[model samples]
Target: MTQAQTGLPDVNAVGLGAPFGWLAGGWRDFTKAVGPCLIYGALLVAASLGLTAALYHAGAIRVLFVVAAGFMLVAPILAMGLYQTGRMLERGERPRVGDILFVKSAIRQDLFILGFALFLVYSVWVEMAHLVYGLSTHKFHKTLPEFVHFMLADPEGHNMVMTGTIIGGIIAFLAFSLVVVSAPMLLNTKSNVFVATLTSLRTVATNFLPMLLWGIMIVALTVLGIVTGFVGLIVTFPVIGLASWRAYRDLVPSSEGDVAAAAG
Candidate 1:
């Protein structure tokens, strides 16, 4: 019900099945430009694997789970390129791989502010994750084997997992509400971070059921990516990113039409 004072249109209320449409549109965009999309996905996969490997090598692999969770917190920024590709495709324009890199140049300030907000949120989640683990386990885990033992054999570890999941869920939900629409909206228009964020929250509030379903789908696919040795991300990440743009397209009204309606 909240309106954008800056003349942005009201949030569109989508059906429960709308997320699937977004996915289909995203798939089309991704496949139409497979080469560039794959490159983007591969970059993400490589970074994930590289960071995981570094953690394993450093004997701090137990912290890798937290690191993985942190990825979702900053995923909006990561998907900026895909949003660009989606917008380009929508406008019947072909996007090069380099377009993804240069897209941030236009909104450097807004992106920076959004990025800092995301980072701050992620930092809080990280600290909360640590606190959850500490409160639940009451001891340190030094290795993967130790971590596994604690989770499977220790009763306290079980409590930790439960508590962490609940807290992490709240954090993820808040992060989702904050940027689910704003990220793409930022790329598509000349709006400040606050306006975009407000629009995003409005979208989530107005379409809570569908947004919740979409959130569940995102998490399911992400888990699938991680389970497949991060190989699934080669497709999952880009598709999600592209699909997100479709989501934005549906949720936010077109600027031109909305402005015309306002004037008339």
Candidate 2:
């Protein structure tokens, strides 16, 4: 039966090591347009740092955990420029600063819809974090180091971290499954948000291991970037974005017939 007959989208499965290959591909793309890519990454990092400082200024350092997780939720929208860079590089065309920055092609209704969905998901994440902290009100972290020690060294705080991690992981994965392919796909195709998100979910289910590895790699690299005072994001952010574009391109087939070819 054809992919349409079987009621499946045109997607492919890959080995677990495929994500690493995608990362390598991203690095190549980055080198081809380092200046533009790095500039794009810097803009993102600046926003992140600004928001973080705002939170600190507001005496809400305790909710930094939620903010961090929320980044994973909304990051796809932030990486649109990087996706454009990848697209240009794939065409053997040099990416210009204005091309990636303005990204005139990305100004579409479907992309806005996708961004809205991510925003909703992020809102839910924030509410959940508030609930978690509200459950245990005995301790309040007024600073970063205090929050770290509370989460790492205290028993109740450890439990709270575990709970938040488990819950946040589930929500984060849902966001990832929805956006992994759909975000970049919507940028490149005329697909509606519903079809694009469905394809993203199906792609994740079909390539669980590789996608899992990919998710781990994303978190690891992002944490690495964050640890370096958000400096490393100048490189890691675009690499992950470029690699994610590669991942989406690899998982989604261009032709309906390719599904059968992949199944074979």
Candidate 3:
């Protein structure tokens, strides 16, 4: 059987690599990984709900803002565990569900790096949105107050929001190009963060179109999960995690271990 058929890495695998055939093997891995994902998701939901409830009982509309902020803080950390669990499963190893809580060892560093990178991207996106809004407001300075009132009352406000969202999204896409593959690569390897980040940026630049498609798919699936109130996340998270491992295995150039094993 060919290496690809056997789920082995191929030397010829390049940018955009093949769809991981191991995705067919995912059902079994899903069974093994689902428990932890569900547990984690449940904990997140409970914490979020509890916090939101507390704020609401205190008569705070700001509770929604707090919940949103908390989610932004926790999502990346939870994602690290999700991704790590998939990696363990891919290696046919058992992974503890609780390992999600601890961030020691190489995994911790990698998670921090990823979290920091994500925070950077989020900060930039937020700043860009503010900048755009500021610019628009400035340009219409004399009418700004009236315009704001009109926007608040008009159905066209939805369109305005959508346009702003699309612009923010483009900015985020540009930022992720520097870190997407690198985050997982850093998690899986002992490589330095700078190297990992650069490698990821290089991969995206070289495979821009396919990577963009992959990004869109990820965003769509994630939004679908949100629409389902996170129940869909149990499945979507693991699938994406496995897909990421496969993508990383495909795109990042092989290391010494890979070469040695290939020679052996």
Candidate 4:
């Protein structure tokens, strides 16, 4: 049966260690275009730092977890430039500052649609965070430390924690499934939002184990970036971005004609 008929997109079977290879390839790409890649990384870090500061100023530090999770919700759109860089590398060209900054080819109607859909998902999560917090805890803490104590020690807070974690986990997985491959597909190909999204879901279904490992790696590095006060993101952000591109490259097959054209 053909892939199209079976409704399973053509995807490579990735090994358990495949994500690490992608990371290594990503590191190489980062070094190959160190200046531009670092600048891209810095931009991501700056944004993260800005959000953190805003949260602190708003005295909503307790919601920082929601914010961080929301950051991941939109991260694929943020990494379009990095995907372009990977494309350039694959085409036997050095990544340029302009390519890393403005991916002209990736700017299309479908990309916008994908972005808007992700934004909607993020908005829903934000609203759900409010509901979850309300249903989870009896009182909101005024200080960050107090919130931490409530989350860790209070009996009512424990219930909130359980409920929030369960609901948030599902939301996170849904976001991951929706964007993991579709975002890169939109950036790299002529696929529409619906096709890209369906393909992404199929890829996940067909390769659940490796994809789970990949998702875990992404979350771990992101948490590390947050724990380091967003400093580690200077490296982690671009690394993950580039590595995601590699993942897309590995999973999706190229058209033979396109491959031949590139070779020519």
Q: What would the per-residue lDDT of candidate 3 be over residues 8-122, giving only the tens digit for each residue?
A: 3223234443433434344456677677767765665566557666665665542243244334323534565655666666566777777654524335566577677777766
Position 82, candidate 3: lDDT: 57
TM-score for each candidate, following the candidate numbering: 0.92, 0.92, 0.68, 0.91
TM-score of 1: 0.92
Off by over 4 Å in 2: 1-9, 256-264
Error of 3 at 221 (Å): 1.0
Model 2 agreement with the true structure over 50-168: per-residue lDDT tens digits: 98898888988876667876787888888988888887777678889998899765798889989998888888889988888778557677888888888788887878888888888
Task: Decide which is better by lDDT, 1 or 3.
Answer: 1
| RMSD of candidates 1 onward, in order | 3.3, 4.0, 7.4, 2.3
Ordered from best to worst lDDT, the candidate numbers read 1, 2, 4, 3
The lowest-lDDT stretch of 10 consecutive residues in candidate 2 is: 255-264
- CA deviation > 4 Å runs, candidate 3: 1-28, 47-77, 106-114, 130-156, 257-264
**Model 1 local distance difference test score:** 0.84
lDDT of each: 0.84, 0.84, 0.57, 0.82
Off by over 4 Å in 4: 3-9, 257-264
Q: Ranking under TM-score, best-scoring first?
A: 2, 1, 4, 3
